[model samples]
Target chain A: MLELDRVGVALGPKAIFNDLSLTIGPGESVCLVGPSGAGKTTLLRLAAGLLAPTSGEVTNGFRETSVVFQEPRLLPWRRVTDNIALGLKARGIGRRHRRARARELAAAVGLAESLDCFPHQLSGGMCQRVALARALAVGAELLLLDEPFSALDVGLRSDAQQLMQQLVQERALAMMLVTHDLIEALRLGHRVLVLAGSPAALVYELPVTTPFNERTPAWLHEAAARLLRQPLVQASFQPLVDREAA
Target chain B: MAAWVRRLLRGIGSLTGVLLLVTLWEWGSIRYGSFMLPGPRDTLTAMGRLAEQQALLAAMWATSWRAITGFALAALAGMALGLLAGLSRTLGRVLEPVATVLLGIPPIAWIVLAILWFGSGSLASIYTVAATTLPIAFAGAQMGARTLDARLAELATAYRLPLAQRLWDLYLPHVVSYVFPALITALAVAWKVTVMAELLATDTGIGAGLALARVNLDTAAAMAWVVLVVVLLLVAEHGVLRPLQRRMEPWRTGH
Candidate 1:
């Protein structure tokens, strides 16, 4: 389980988050959905332990954590397999065993043929798949994803979402994904939280009851539209535009 | 096969141009009928004579060592300083203008100062070479570091990559793009400046050998020394530097 207790983050003179709290138990998946610049990424970074909160504590039971950033952060100089092997290498795994694990993960992500290809040689979708494979290869109990599929085409995004669902189910791992795309949130998240305003705070939390196999695009879009139509959602987003204009 | 053919054609064209220039030199020498205008054949014969005396080998070694040592020092110092400057805005502001001034000063203008500092020996030659080479290396390293992708760095930090891995895998690779051209330029300048410094300050090396030939009014020997330096430059370019560059940056080949 991973827990954020009354977390507050200050960036320079501005508060990015204040009095935020959340918890993810084993095998649970959560998504933070918000308009652009609602500090979803900042929240994700804190949860991943890549950054520390200004106040409050983040407690984790997991020994390992992995993050899939908005950009596919695969090393440009490394081949797909090597990038996937990075986490294992960090943990002092033997080279041969690490390569074997990378191969397995690459195959799982449908990037078997691209094992030797460098990041620049792959398409945007392929790079994201590589990133996903890298995260999964780490064998982390908690995965933090920040708009992992934002660059992919709709079809590729859906495929990646399905892959994420399968990985979560198979490993029984907890994940927190941050995205502006409501449809993606509805499809992949077991629970979705809406974040808003300056010194951003969670406005709503919605539980997703739809099964992975049973969910349809039309139904997902309808749920997303309903979520967006909430008055709090509009009110939450308004402050961002006003802040920027000022 | 087509690529090979194209490369072969380019080589042939270069050879043809050199041959034409040699032919012209021979014609001009025949018309002039003087040692001052020695033809390609005469220069080649003079080179053979110098080789027989073994002075050419000693001179080549002396000049080569000076250039190599000086350039190596410049590379080390420049990269260290450049990384500092690249990572810190204040350091860059403090040093860049000084580097620019040093770079602007001609190599010849510094020869007298180098002799005064190092006292008329191989050290003088090495100092001059390093002085000329440092700015190129410094600028290249700075540019390389500045242009490295911030996203990649953020990724590295997020992954908690260890210092060694970050340097070897990310920083080194990113710096190579600028470093290669800078290194090539530095090497060429180092050799030229070292030889020139030796000519004025010392009694060894190819440059001093040329000075000795001039004092004796042996134009052929002087020309022979010049030929030796040119040959060394070509060998270093092809046998050492080109191969190193290719090995360091294989991805650049397709681009």
Candidate 2:
């Protein structure tokens, strides 16, 4: 379980979050949706323990945690297998054991043939897959991803989403994914949280009980449309556009 | 064209340039006379004569030894200090200007000081070479260490990389890329500076051989020594440094 209890984060003099609280239990998938610069990435960083909240408490009960960033962030010099094995290496695992585990994860993520290829040789989608495999390699109980599939094209996005969904189910991993795409939120999250305004706080939360395999594309789109029709969801996104126009 | 054939063509093209230089040298020799400017053949003959005396191999060996030892010292010390300075702001401020001052000082000035301090021996020559090349290596290594990608650092932090793994997998590879080019530059400087220091302060190596030729007024012998130095530098650069760089940066080369 991961918990951010009434967290407040301030960067220098400016506050990015005030009184924001969220939790992810074992095997739960939560999606955070907001406009750009609404502190979605900041919230993920806080959860990953990469950032400390200015006030309140963060307690992570998971043995291991991993993050996949907006960019793949694969080390350019390391081959795909080595990059995927990074988290395992951090745990002081033996070379042969870690490499075997990396190979298995690479095959699982559809990168079996690209194990020897460097990050520079892999496509954007392939690089994301490598990042995903790296996050899984540590046997992390909690995975925090910040817009991991945003850079992929539509076809690749859906493919990556399916991969993420399958992996999360297989491992019974707790996940918190941040993205701006409503349909993506509807498709992946067991619960969706919408963030709004300066010093952003959660504006709305909705729990989707549909099984992963049962959520068809048309159903996802219709569900997303229904969520977007809510006054709070519209208001949550309005401030950024109004500011842009101003 | 096939890759090997293309490489062969490139070799031939470079050979043509060398032939052109030789032709120009021969023309200059004829116009100015062999006493003033030895022809390529005369220099070659002088080289053969030195080889017969066994002096040529010994001189080449001494010069290579001094240059390589000095370069090794400079590389180890400079890389260690540069990495330290790069990692800490206070240390960087203290060391960066000192490096700049060292770089500003001329190699001849260093050689003279080294000879005074070490009393005209191998120590003098080695010290001069190391001092002249250390700043260059330090600057390269410092830049490399300073420019480590912050994103990767974040990734390492998130993964909770152990200190040893962080240094080996993250810091060293990035630093080597910058340091390798600096080391190559320092190496080229090492050869020239060693020869200069030897000519002034030592009685061995290629520089001393050039001095001997000067005293005897043997233009061909002097030219031969110059030729040997050039050959050694080319062998060090193209034959050694380039191959090492290629091996280390295979990803950068798309290989």
Candidate 3:
């Protein structure tokens, strides 16, 4: 479990967020959906204990947490298996045992064949899968993903999302993901939260408790229509869609 | 097979350049007269003469050993200080000025102080070389460390990578990239300073041999020593350093 209680963060002269708070309970999948510069990534960093808030407190109770960054962030020097093994290696697992475990994780992520490949040699989607595999290899109770699927092709993104859904549910992993894509948030998250405005605060929260892996197109459209009906969520969409339509 | 051909052609191209230089030297020798500027042939003959006496090999060994010893020490000190400075803002602020001051001081100035302290042995040469080269490695390390990906460090911290694991997996690879070019530069400076120091202070290395040749007015022998020094530098950079770099960063080579 992770909690950011009434957090305030100001970088230089600009304030990113004031009096913002969030909590991700055990086995909870919370997706943060926001405008382009809504400090979603910064919020994730705050929860990961990477950045201390200008005011207020963050309490994280998870024994282990792993993050999949926007970029794959694999070591260029390491092979796919080695990169996956990194968290285990850091946890003092032996080389032979970690390698075996890494291969297993790679298989779970559908990257077993790429175990010997370098990051540079892999396709973008494959690289993202490796990043996912790496996070899973940490055996962390909490997984934070920052647009990890944003760069992939739509079909690949769906596949990765399915893998993520399966694994998270199977392991009962708590997760916080940041994304701008409404459909993705709706597709994968148990609950979706939105932020808007310059010094943003949480504006809307939607709970979509349908079994995500089994959700239909009709369910998605109905949820989208409902999300669009939220005054604050609709307001956040106005500036971008109105300008694009004009 | 294609790779081999490309490699062979590259080798041939390099050899051709060397041959061209040798031919130009021969022409210059004929024009200037052998006494003033020896031909490559005359330099080779003098090398053989010195080699027969075993003086050339001994002097070469002496100079190379001193340079290498100093280079190794400077690398250790410089990299350690560099990492310290990069990792700590206060240390960076303190050391930046110190490294700048050291860099500003000439190696020749250090040679005088080194001789005064160590009294004209390899110690003076070795110390002068290390003192002159430290700032280069230090600067490289600092820049490398400063620019390292913050995300990588964050990942390491989140994973609770032990200090040693962070070092081996993350910090060292990044630091080494910066350290390498500096090491190459430091090596060149080490050789130059060691010889200059030996010319003034010691009597056992190639620098002393060159000094003796200057006194006897044997231009070819002096030229031969110059050739040997250049050869040693080439061998160190190409033979040892490059291969070591390739071994350390095999991932960088193909893709």
Candidate 4:
């Protein structure tokens, strides 16, 4: 289990998040959805241990934590296979074994043919897939994704989401995905949390039962739109809506 | 056929331009009737005489060795110092100003000081060349180090790449891009400054040969020596520098 208890973060006198708490049990997928600058990214960063909260603690049961940022962040100088092998190499795995593992993961992600290609050669979707493969290869029980598929076109985005669903199911991984797109949240997340207001607070929590792999894109989009029209979510948008009405 | 002919015409035009300049030079020399303005024919004759006496070849070899050795030393030392400075802010702050000052000083000033310390020989010339070239290498390496992608470094940190792998795969590749241009510029400066230093503080090398020609009032031979230096620079640029630069730009292979 991964838990964040009363997490508070202040950046240079500006509170981005305060008293924020969430938990993910084994094999559960959670997504945080909110407006831009909602501290969704910050919460994910905290979970990954890439950032520390000003108040409150994050508890992790696993030895490894893997994060996939919005950008692929692949090393430009390294080939795709080598990039996937990065975590293995870091853990002091033998070169031959790491290479084999990287090759296997690359194939699993449909990137086997691009093993020798550099990051610059890959398309945005391809690069994200590589990033996904890299995170999976790290064997982290908890995966933190910060808008990992925000750059992809619609078709590729659904394909990547499907791949992620399969991987999460197979590995029994706990994940916290941060996204501004409600459809993405509805598709990939078992539960969705909303972050809102100044200093950032978790305003809403909703359970989503639609199996990520079984849901059609249309179904996900409809559910997502309906959630956006909810009293709480619409009320959060009241200021802008009122100004437009006037 | 049209493309080939156009290329041929462009080449011929360049050659004709050079020929026209030479023709003007020869005509002026013949009209002036002065040794100072010796014609191309007279310079070439002087070159032949020097070659026949074997002095030209010996001088060329002496100058070349001093410049090459000095450049090699400067490249090695400068790159090491640059890496040190780049990796540490304190080291950069302490050494960078000193390097800037040393670089600002003229080669002639270095030659005079070198002569006082090492006496009038190739040692003085070598020291002068190395002094002039060191800053160029250091600045290039420093820029390379500073400009390396921070994201890549963060990735390296996240992955926890081993020391050896980080140095070879990350640092060295970035360094190589800076090293090539630095090496070329430093080598060129080393060659020119070595000759100038040799002219002032040495008794052997092309600079000394030029001095001997000047003493004898043989303007033709002096001009011939100047021509020889230009030719050597061209040869080195094509034979050494260009090949190395091409080899370093492997990423441009397909593009």
Candidate 2 wrong stretches, greater than 4 Å: none
Better of 1 and 4 by TM-score: 1
Please tell me the TM-score of chain B in candidate 4 relative to the true structure's chain B.
Answer: 0.90
Predictions ranked by TM-score, top down?
2, 1, 3, 4
Candidate 4 lDDT by residue in tens digits, A119-215: 8888999999999888888788888898999989999998898888888888888889998888878877889888877887888888988666567
Chain B TM-score by candidate, in order shown: 0.93, 0.97, 0.96, 0.90
Please tell me what DockQ candidate 2 reaches.
0.75
Tens-digit per-residue lDDT, B51-87, candidate 2: 9999999999999999999999999999989988888
lDDT of each candidate versus the true structure:
0.86, 0.93, 0.89, 0.85
Fraction of true interface contacts that also occur in model 3: 0.53
Select the stronger candidate by lDDT from 1 and 3.
3
TM-score of each: 0.90, 0.96, 0.89, 0.83
True contacts kept of 4: 0.32
Can you write out model 2's per-residue Cα lDDT over A1-246, one digit (the tens) per residue?
999999999989999989888889999999999889899999999999999899999999999899999999998888998999998988989999999999999999999999999999999999999999999999989999999999999999999999989998888999999999999998899999998888898999999999999999999999998898899998887877698999
lDDT, candidate 1, B1-255, per-residue tens:
699999999999999998998788789888986478777777888888878988778888999999999999999999888878887889999989978998999999888898787788988888888888998999999888878888877777767788888888788988987888998888888888988998998888899988988898877777777777878888898889999988777655523
Model 2 chain B TM at 0.97
lDDT of 1 by residue, A1-246 (tens): 899999999988999989899999888899898879889999998988878999999998887788999889887777888899887887778999999999999999999998988888889999998988888887888899999988888888888898998898888888999998888888888998999877789998899998877779889989888887888876776676687899
- The superposed Cα distance between candidate 3 and the true structure at residue A172, in angstroms, equals 4.8
Residues B1-255 of candidate 4: C-alpha lDDT, one tens digit per residue: 698999999999999998998999999998987575999999999999999999999999999999999998899899988888887889989989989998999998999999999999989999999999999889888877777777676566655678887787678878878877888888889888988998899888999999899899999999899899988987898898878776655443422
TM-score of 3: 0.89
What DockQ does each candidate score versus the true complex, computed on alpha carbons? 0.42, 0.75, 0.60, 0.35
List model 3 lDDT by residue over A1-246, tens digit each: 798999999999899999898989999999999888878999988888888999999999998889899989888778898899999997888999999999999999888788888888889999989988889887889999999999988899888888888887899999999999888889889999997778888999999878865677688878888898888999987777777899
Number of the predicted model whose lDDT against the real structure is largest: 2
